[model samples]
Target: MHIRRLAAGLGAAALLLLTAPAAGGAPAVDPVTLDGPGQITDQVGALGSRKPDVEDALRRLDTEHGVQLFVAYVRNFAGRGAQDWADATATKNGLGQNDVLLAVATRDRQYAVSAATDSGFTEDQIREVNATAIEPALRQNDWAGAAIGGADGLGAVLAGDPVPAPAITPGPANPGGDGGAEQFTASDVIIPVVAVGGAGAAALYLFSSRRRKRKDTGGGEPAGWGGDGGAPPVTPLPELDDRAKQLLVETDDAIRTSQEELGFAAAQFGEATAAPFDQAVTSAKEELTRAFRLRQQLDDAYPEDDATRRAMLEEIVHRCTEANKRLDAESASFDQLRQMVTKAPEVLANAEAAAARLPERITAAETALTAMTGEYAESAVTAIAGHPAEARDRLQFATQHLGEARTALDAGDGNTAAVHVRAAEGAVDQAETLAGAVLRREGELREAAAKTAAAIRDTQADLADARGMVTGTRQDESTADLRGRIGRAESVLAEVGREVAAGRYDPLSVLRRVEEADAGLEEALTGAREREDGERRASALLDQALLTARSEVDAARDFITTHRGGIGTRARTRLHEAERHLDQAESLGATDPATALQHAQRADQLGEEARRLAEDDVSGYGGFGGPVPMGGGLNTGMLGGLILGGMLGGGGRRGGGFGGGFGGGFNPGSFGGAGTTGRMGGGGRF
Candidate 1:
């Protein structure tokens, strides 16, 4: 049994789907339509405990008033587009069983509204729905909302008793004329209709009729759609119904025909004759675009507030559709003419007008799109300049041609104007490419200048640094070179000191011997300086002494040629042996002739060298000073010098009261025993 029932339900659904009429279908018959003055329909359903008045009203509308009533429960709003919503909307509206939905001429010149009813609605309730919801939705350009809200609000109104005063608000102001004084009325489509039960319906009928009469007689006030009263007068747009859109399309076609004729005439004028026809054509084309744009503006602006704006937009959409059709036809004609040289002037003129038309429209669209999308609108340049270089060139050429057109226009040469406008479009196309190239060049120049400036600064700094170095104003290469040399010399000195500390050699002994030689040379040189009269003789003696000193130094150099070798010179060896004997004799406090002789000879050699260098050498700056021996806690020198000769006779040995004091235990001068003859055990005295 359940399976059978399910199948029956499915069959019923299929039947309904096939039979249901489209939402915009023909006007419904009596009882299904909400029309006429003072006539109303009651829409209500049976509750658990149904009200008698509600049920009776439903029955009366269905039977006496020919109203149809129904009840529908839907799961979601998706059902709004379905037959369910249509039936539900009707059920919520009351209509006579035989009454039809309102029938207003589809091709009327004013706005019209109609509805169907499966559920009937009261007259007052329908008014309330139109005011509170339907009207507002329409004004705001919310068509779908207007439809759904009209249904919903109607339902709410019909579910209750009629109030003395309905809760409906007034409609928004009419931008085209005086607010409440303006009215839209029906025309001469006479169908005897039963009125609804309200003053509201009566008012609607009266207003509709008056508007229709005004339209027939062409007596309606000349007012633009905008509220600005001083605006140019505009003919009333066709009635906003389904067929209104078709009317707009027809109008668009008419406009294009007019433009084409004008353009042909314009071309003829350019043949070295009167150019009036060409002027007329250009003017006509411009006027056509202007008229189309104006219509769009009206459609967009009417219904001054949210209450009527939606209807206005819908009307505008129709206008746009019509305008687009005309545009397409004109464009196609232009394409055809473009292929023919005779019609080329007209084609070119049309293209120019089109180019001009797009800017304002695109701008307006961008603003609208921005508001709608909540993002930055595309730049005007981008929107108009199609793609790559082609877009740029087109725009550039167009602009240039426009300038030429303007010049021709100013000069009253319409033939030339047409030609120039064509050229301008081509110029417009090249603009983008030219602009890009210019920008690239500018960027490169700026970058090069920056690099040049930086390089200049760097060079200047380097020059300044070089100059500073020359004068020691800055620590430069020259200064650094001198510092490095000084630092190296100090390092060498330090290294030598360190070697002495580490016992690398008998440093003290070596130093003493070097000091003794240096001292004798100084003394001899000083004596040579004192004798001016015998300078030559003194210089000769000094020269002999210098040779002996040099010989001795040479002998020393040969004996101690290297640290790793034994003394190699015989003179150095014999002298060194004699010094040792003298040293032993000195330990016994005895003076030896042999040791004394060796010491004297060594001392004499060094002293003579000093004399020669100081007196005989002409390069000597002045006199030389002799060495001053320092005393210590040891015995004095025991080996006396062979002779002393400070104030004594020159060139001869002179005796002294103790010619030499005891030579000390260690004396640098005793390295070569001075005239020493004593052996250790055979010393004369101790």
Candidate 2:
């Protein structure tokens, strides 16, 4: 499982680090509630008690060591590379420097650790941590151990302790303990060599003319040049050059249209609501600009390489294609937001309802604020001191907008009324948040004070647990960090307890201090387990990809072998290419799963084509002559695993086909939410 890595590695936390922003976008992931300073989202379940232990360790990592670890366990990577998915999650979460994300898509049997470019851990350190702590436990199907190991490993690095060494000692090769490689038959060794040689020879033959025309041949001019040293035909669409130019112009017009639409929409739905659409249009324009630059370079006076021009031309189309895709992804949402202009009356009603609630809400908020002021010290109420004033200002703003809305409605301008309604709604919501904040603050403080008392007890228990893990303690190097932690917790909690009882303090602040002061303990977040006791590892997605490819290839080969007499060159040729690609995949599988996946996918595509061609050839043969009675005892063993298929109608092979990841079927969900103050960088294959 070769995983592509992503970096949140924090609040700038993760996203796919790609030169071209891999066309895939993240899935519509419902937001996870990140309450703790450090945490893990165990979406695959099965962690039980270990989830908290691991989270406590992560909290310790952050509180004590100044590093945050954001962990996620998804069912699978699904629509994007591990790195891309990981990065997107991190970025969406808005994790910052000193924060790192440990994303485990165990169902896919792949993991990626992402950190910001400026994170405390280096690339080399991340690699070390994964090898020594993460992957070994993963390979053993120990999810809890993997998570704990990550915490333990990162903790060691932060404490300036030696990071653990690689834990994967290669096992006895054949289980015979002779230290030799696993046994394979002579044919196993022979087939790939013959396949590679055959494929290479065929490709060389088919591409020879283009290859010869590619560079300056032995002759000073060049062999096989198409007059003005034209690019050798690469794409099947000969009109691609014309198509590229047309797409570029069309996309540019689309971008301009978007900009104009954005202007109109921004007035109704403020800049914040319109920001994503603006970003999409900007990104699309940048891509279009790059395409134009490529086009300009292509038509320049300088002598260009034939391959370079062809590549640039293809790239022009690709750039335009990507630009169009980005725009397309946002079009519906953009259009819907704009359509809100027609819903002005509805919007105004809602805004008016919000305004009506302000008077009682503000009075309740101020009354609540005043009652607390007398009982608690001013320091205790500092957080909400301005909450009432802020609520008042927002109410004033809302009233102003509400008046504008009525005026716009009188003028029969729905768009203007919609704009006023949006502003009034925002102002009212802010006033509500401000009022709610003061009311909620009272409950939060009382809750925090109670929690502070509990935290003290927890700290004491944590110390006992710390001591319990130790035996006949001479406090060796291994236990030194824990020992130091216990000593520090004991000293800090003593002072904290005395101060908390003596005078008023921010209970939330005290809790954070206690968390930092204490040794590791339980995390409070109850994760939403996506699967009830799922498997140790997800069925390997890449393995499934390969299996499907092989099925398609085998089906095609069997059908062709059964009807070789009727099958023409097209079907046989496609089948040969499929076999060749499959062979290449097998050869490369051990070293490169990413590229192996690509070849396997190609094999699947070609095999499908071959099966269709073979079916057509067999069916057309029936029209030419009466069906020959099936031969009874033809030994098909030497023909390489032939099977009875397609009973003269579309059957077995038709039901089974494999296809590509396909033109980035990424429908990205909305990105902003609570606790998501992110600025992290991107990700890639690890």
Candidate 3:
């Protein structure tokens, strides 16, 4: 009668529930589908009381942020792993971008949270949420808590908000009582027992027989069975065999070599002066002692059981490995210490010398800035003012750091002193750069102003000579226009001289305007000469101008091509423009000699600008200490304005993310979640 009842139960269970298909077979159940926004399906009824809360969280997330969330619980995954099952389920359901699926294999004791590709959650963030919010609840068998907490945490992360801490329930030390009977629910035992028929029954009978035998012998099951039971016989580690002896010999040789190197480093660098080297030597000595003691222990514990001998050998091997690692680290540290010690005196001297010269350099830079501002009230003088101010500030900073470094050196803290010295040196370099830029700019302005003035004077003299030759000659309408233009050019030249004397003009702009006036005077003079001496003289002047322009253009082109790799995009563009202007000049040289000369001159100027730009790039200063003209008016406010503008204009956007540091011990890349396919997220074990 009992056998018949068992057969009936098996038949009924088989008809109601089928196992998942074997590998290479069709799936036993249809793929899961997410039918609603807040649906939480519990195939195994694991999330018994928590389904409503989980559903509410999912609905809220979807409504607020358009992030879809799905949760599921199943008894088993058949033969499919949790990761594979979750991926297949998500694909079959046509999960859209930013959709997230959390699947739990209750019987398999595994879970996976799969996210769509466009989800904002990063792998690190997802891992943190799971470890902090969901895993704690799962550990205490609170399935409902896991689902609700996980949903809320994920929702918070997706919304760019902080996740709330998980609420944990305290449980007894041991949930299973001390009676030692294996606990099983009806569903857990009956389903598996019925699936395999009498074979399952025979396994249960054998387990019962083993328990009876253990009870009769007064021997509790094993130590890990949650009962006060006798431990199984421990295998004694083996004594030092030939292999162990050989390792010990090698370890001793390594220790001796390390000691020799340490001694040499100490002698060369002065042991009394090298604190790190002394400390490392002490540590290496202590580690060697420990290694020797471990070897001796293994050697003395002879004639032991095979297990005991093996254990002893393993301990010796561990000690030797650790000792070797320590020796290597010590050796490298001592080598660095030696280099630092040898260079300390020279570095200190150089830093002291630089500090001493800071005041003179600062004063010189200030004088240059003052002179620049007095001579030119343009933006270039204002821009140049900022460099001196920055230099002064950096010098002060360097002084402070240098003082600290000296104090540290006096206190015999070489390592700390070295750090301060390096900082001081960096500050000094920046100060020098700033001051140098000011000095260089002032020199360039003076040179450019003088050259432009000279050009204006020479062209004015030439025009006067031409005007004398045409004095009292027969004048036509064209000659009348030429005379009027010459008068205009002279007026502009006087105005430029007045602005320069008042220190209210930009050097480059003044240069440009002066050059324009010179060109106009030359053209007017040329027209007058042509009327006096015919087209032959006019052609001669045009030919001379064109030759000069061609020579300058050729030089500029050669310079640009030679430094092509170092030139920037702006300079390259200017060079191409120069080429275009040159081509135009060539096309018009025969038809309009005067116009062709102007075009060629313009091309020459552009080529010179391009060459200067390329040279600045090659020098690594990016025109910082180069002759590029800055053109704004100068005043006390201008200095501050220039400095502020430079700071803001040079600033660029920076990107970064949060990172965790060591707590109990060293941890690297261990806190983040595992990255999943098609998702910006990761997972971790509970």
Candidate 4:
């Protein structure tokens, strides 16, 4: 790290210290009062059965990394920024450096990740963790996952391992005028679909007119996804409005149906075979969450900004579009995996074929690992060290599942049979991939070593240039720093030389070390030439700028589209600003690339900022607003369809799903006929 970067880090700490006791604001909801330090205050009950998992993970983070993670879910941030509110909460709880607070405002759809000064993370790193690990999970309303991801990502930074990949960029601003949406008229596919009687399915849902009456802020004028988050259109466009509501119902119904199928699949085939489907469902749920949240905001009696409201509706439509797309994409794979229910013999036979090949693959992998170990250092092969063992384990797992499938076939339990066969197939396939990785890695490492050696030489030359510059009086204090940098680079080069000589070191590590050392030398050295792009013509720059601005805006839009449940107004506002700037830049066309570039740059900055703000909200949110109807019966009709978001009453009721719902839990089993077009109103969305 550079000296300037360190000072910035320290300054950040001081600022937080000075502002620890955040002042009160016009909070829409009261902040939860914490009793003490390191509290996992689940005021909103986000971490249901997974509380233990989060506790264990967080405990491990603190126990092993000397960092404390405190979490709180509240109604809203007391009318303050999520970060400020989090800081105040941490300070009020008497927390110090090495302490981080993940604060979430349930009703506000906002969150923040705040840490004390000495938490061993720069603001950038904090934001990175939030964006890469935490937000993706949080946006899905996987509250526990968000918390766990935070702990894992922070730990990875400390451990000097590669951090998780950055979250995917949000969909493009206009989302390419919506991708070619595949109309789904066929029964939504779930393997071994449970047959639910229509009357029984209807019996399960007691749509209390009163319960339905309350969440319907449209006063029964037709809302999107009826819930606490349901909202009516600002001005109805009959087709769009109908589509939005119908889509919400269909999407929600699809998610419910998919979840049921997933559970059954997981039970029979194990989680491995159903992993992809899980991701799709999870993604759809998050999208619906965003759609519902937007709907909720629209429904709120607050005075409206027409543009903002229109944007929200547009966003809702986009969200619904994406949710259905995800489900549709995975349908084929999901349906195929469920074939064991009807074709148990054939499925089992396929697994046996995979099972036979796996053993041979495992042996080859073991041989490859052994051969590589003799030629490379331990670090060089550390990545693939477990490949052989893992493959062997999966082979055994597959074999066991195969046996189970056969037994289920004998017992005439087709569903169970299908599950085991799918599990076997999945395990075998994974075993093959694991086995193959060993061979692939060996070649990759060999080539990387060669490339890395060349890079090392190039870096050595750069170090020498830096050393040459260190002798001048112009160096001043920087000269001393230059000497230190040269010394470090020299040491790295010498070590790499020895490794190259031995031909037995971690090539990846060597490459990274050399690169970092090179970067350090650059930072210490004086001036470099201006960026070449600056020399480009205004037209050229403007064209490039327009493209860049569009990309950033698109990404921000995609992120907001999916993760709307946890994001707040600032993110949406930021994205809107980005869009305006983008439009301005595009309006310039070729006439003013230079001027357009400026607007484009602003758009890019705001677009990224919008994403950052959204990530912050996701990381901070601890509430799972997906309503799980409890006793009293589900009033799931946003306008007419079943309400998936059991969240009816807003503001105070953050613990709707896990703690309890308006009605008793709306059993997915009760909605079983919903698995197909067999029941649950007509064939609209499902």
Question: Highest TM-score: which candidate?
Answer: 4
* Local distance difference test scores for all models: 0.32, 0.56, 0.53, 0.57
lDDT of 2 by residue, 1-686 (tens): 00111111211221222211233322333333334543767655636556676777677766665566778766557656677677666656555444577887654556788765434355677777887787777776666667777777887876668766433333211111111223345664456556555654564454455545654454443323323454574664447667776666456545543564475467557899999998988788678767766765554468577667668779988888888778767764664565444667766876787689898998998898887776555655654555566567657656866787788677765534554554455456546755776787677556667667766776686667667756576867857766777777788888787767767666654654565554132211102112321111111223434554665576566455434435554565566567767887888776665466567767877777877776666545542233322232111221111111111111111011111021111111111111112223222222
Model 2 residue 330 CA deviation in Å: 4.3
Q: Distance (Å) between predicted and true CA of 481, model 1? A: 90
lDDT of 4 by residue, 1-686 (tens): 22344345445544543333232222254545674544588765667677797888789887666566777766567677676677656545544334577876654557788763323455667777777777776556666777788788777876667567433223212111212223222242221122223322342243344436656765542234333454665555555555665556555555654665576567668898778888888878778767866665665569467667667778878897888777767654565565445667876886698689777777887787787788777855543455566566556656766787788688655544554564456445545655676677666666556667556765676677886776555757767888888988899899888987886776655665665566567555526423443323334435434544564566566444433434555566577567767877888765655567678778877776876676566545544444323122112122111121221112111011111122321111111111121100000000
Residue 525 Cα positional deviation in candidate 3, in Å, after optimal superposition = 8.3
* Lowest-sum lDDT 10-residue window in model 4: 677-686
Q: What local lDDT does model 1 show for residue 174?
A: 22
Give lDDT for model 3. 0.53
TM-scores for every predicted model: 0.15, 0.30, 0.30, 0.34
Predicted candidate 3 versus true structure: per-residue lDDT over 1-686, tens digit per residue? 33354456555655444331111122233347655544576665665555676677777876665556777766445566566777666756545334677776554556777764334455677777778777777677666666667777877875568877667653322222222223335675567646666644664465457667988999766343223453665434333455555555445434433443344344445667555645544554455445444444443436656666577667756666666555544443443453432354556667678778877887898898787777776554543454565566656655765676677577654433444454455446546655665676666566556666666675577568656755787898866866776777677778777887776666655665555665666666654454645344335444444444444444444433322323443444455456666777889877776677677667767666765565455444232233222223112122222221121111111100111011111000100011112333444334
Q: Who is ahead in lDDT, 1 or 4?
A: 4
The best-first sequence of candidates by lDDT reads: 4, 2, 3, 1
- Residue 2 lDDT, candidate 2, scale 0-100: 7
TM-score of 4: 0.34
Hey, what RMSD does candidate 1 come out at? 57.3
Per-residue lDDT over 494-552 for candidate 1, one digit per residue giving the tens place of the 0 to 100 score: 44345445533322222223223322332323333335533432232233332333333
Error of 1 at 411 (Å): 43
